[model samples]
Target: MGAEHYPPPWFSVAPMMEWTDNHYRTLARLISKKAWLYSEMLAAETIVYQTGNLDRFLAYGPEQHPIVLQIGGNNLENLAKATQLATPYGYDEINFNCGCPSPRVAGHGCFGVRLMLDPKFVAEAMCVIAANTNVPVSVKCRIGLDDHDSYNELCDFIYKVSSQSPTRHFIIHSRKALLNGISPADNRRIPPLKYEYYYALLRDFPDLQFTINGGINSIDEVNAARLEGAHGVMLGRAAYSNPWQILGLVDSAVYGAPLRSITRRQVLEQYQVYGDSVVRMYGLKPHIRDVMKPLLGLFHAEPRNVVWKRKVDAALLRCTTIKSILEETLGEIPDRVLDAPLTEVPSGSTDTFIKAKSLLPPPYTVSEEELL
Candidate 1:
């Protein structure tokens, strides 16, 4: 029943290209110290294509421990090269992305999802990485791709990859990656969620350590999957957008690690520091606006702040200070919510103690509709 009794290193964040960059990873670390955080998938060709600064793609901040690097590409030689460069950076795991459906990705004849037709290629690629790297090699794959909708095909591919490199773990994304004109966002929800497809995966491959991803929300849902014999749960948008849920899960739901807790106020404080650091390092330029994005819901309360959010969209723009954004928008965050430790929030007394409980979402800033 308890998460601890379930498995080791069970939950992870799927790599979202722009969304899961260093700034987000820094924020995620402040919440959960142990859950595995994945990088936005790095294109193997992109790494090779850049003439001089491959290090630009490789560098990550120090705070992002227990991290995995997700690489998208089907080219074995180039992937091996990228993995060689990535390994020295202290990546805890190297994951091959086999599920992204962007036509841009498929146009190059790479992207792991398309490798489904030739399970041998996926297996050979995994084998190459496993043989060359000392670190654990893993795969993140959709259940099927193109017109190949058979679960048997999926299992066949999984069996091949596992047969070649049993040391590698598998992360199964239950939806089939679409080839038609459907966008990737729709691909997530449009594929009818048959968690039973994932449950059947556990039934079929009892020898493998399988982690299921896509549309998994809430601790209860994760608990149900673990009961079904999944080795872990991988959360994508829910973990990225609402994030604090993942933090809460790390302590209460997953590790039961004696919580050295950080509060919502502390999170806000950290953001202030982060934004300031960006300004300082990037010379008060576009990076500040990029860094201030987490404050979106906060400023959504006011008309001017809404404009500020959109105007500051570039990675090069910087804000003078977020205090102005806060003051101009929601007046001032209620002292109770501002001061309260979100982890130990008193049942419903958030409403009783906080001054502006109705305006904010759950624990972060206020809803956008109430703009001033």
Candidate 2:
């Protein structure tokens, strides 16, 4: 293993902003203990500001072991300080966010494939974090940005940033991030993914650990990626939606890693425990709504379970009490979410339905300084 090993060829929860918060991570761990988890990408500046209550950002149940904290920022000193604050919470690794294409991130001067243009800074920042923290420091990045489409440029950029001195593992989201007025949603779909590019990273730079991310939604997609020689596969939304599908089977399916058996009902019950804890601790934020969303996939196939998911959906959308929502929608918690948002599927029309990506925010512009 590189630094520490919990599962071979680890899987990760991509750093989605509001979606992958502590509440969701806790719910996810209840589904799969071994799939590596990460916090939503936090800026070094944000961490410094929140260090007094570092527990807020760093608080994870002990059961969620081998979790990595994903952080962003170009300043080496701030990165080092943030890494120090993170270690006490027992992060297995520290990851720098070089992939996100948000304007807020760009306004602060970080993320986007913009960080790749200055691999030297990324390299030094990694060096500082790796030096200061006992935990491993890694990077999650895109191939390159809008104008830098040439595969050669991306390869050269990775070679420069891998900084193979110690921990040379870099998670490559094999697509270009177009940071214009265009949203982050389109960036994932619009940028043509060359899986060949992922395999090329392994062949060209065998010394570095290359994990493939982006557009990975299913087991078949994951298997195809492996055939291309990716060290590991990373999932963003799919893993979130089908946590059990990936985590429940991934241990056996992908890595021959240890398997844990947890049924669908069992998973839902576990989430309830988490849901209760979240309400007790953080009050109502976003995850109350998210926990309800995943349950929809559970009963989608079964006509009866579909009602439960729909009940959950109504409650979640209304931001109402679980008891009240259950009573109102399913008459008895219905057993699962109706498998699709009631508003969308019940009406079922493109013009009326807000698509999944609509839930995601737009891409950010990189400031001139970050471009440098």
Candidate whose TM-score is highest: 2
Collision count for each candidate, in order: 8, 11
Return the TM-score for candidate 1, rounded to 2 decimals.
Answer: 0.80
**Which pairs clash in model 1?**
98-113, 285-316, 286-315, 286-316, 286-317, 287-315, 287-316, 360-366
**Ten contiguous residues with the weakest lDDT in model 2:** 344-353
TM-score of each: 0.80, 0.80
**lDDT of candidate 2 at residue 363, scale 0 to 100:** 29
Q: Note the Cα lDDT for every prediction shown.
A: 0.66, 0.67
How many clashes (backbone atoms < 3 Å, residues ≥3 apart in a chain or on different chains) does model 1 have?
8
Total backbone clashes of model 2? 11
The digit string of per-residue lDDT tens for model 2 on 1-372 reads: 233567754566787887777766776777666677878888888888986667667787887766778899888889889888777778788888888887777545755457878877888888888887887677888878878866677766676666433557888887888887677788778887765566666667778888889887765556555654557888998877666565555555566544554455566556666665555344444445654554555443445665566556666676544444444655443344322221100111232112321332222233455345
lDDT of 1 by residue, 1-372 (tens): 112322366778788887777777777777777777889889877776763665556667766767888887778898787777677777777888788887767556656577777777887888777666677788888888767876666766777778666445788887888778788788887876545556666656667778888877655666656654668888888776666655555656665567565565677677667656554353434355555655554322333544544544532233366544444433344555445453532212222112222222222122243222
Cand. 2 TM to true fold: 0.80
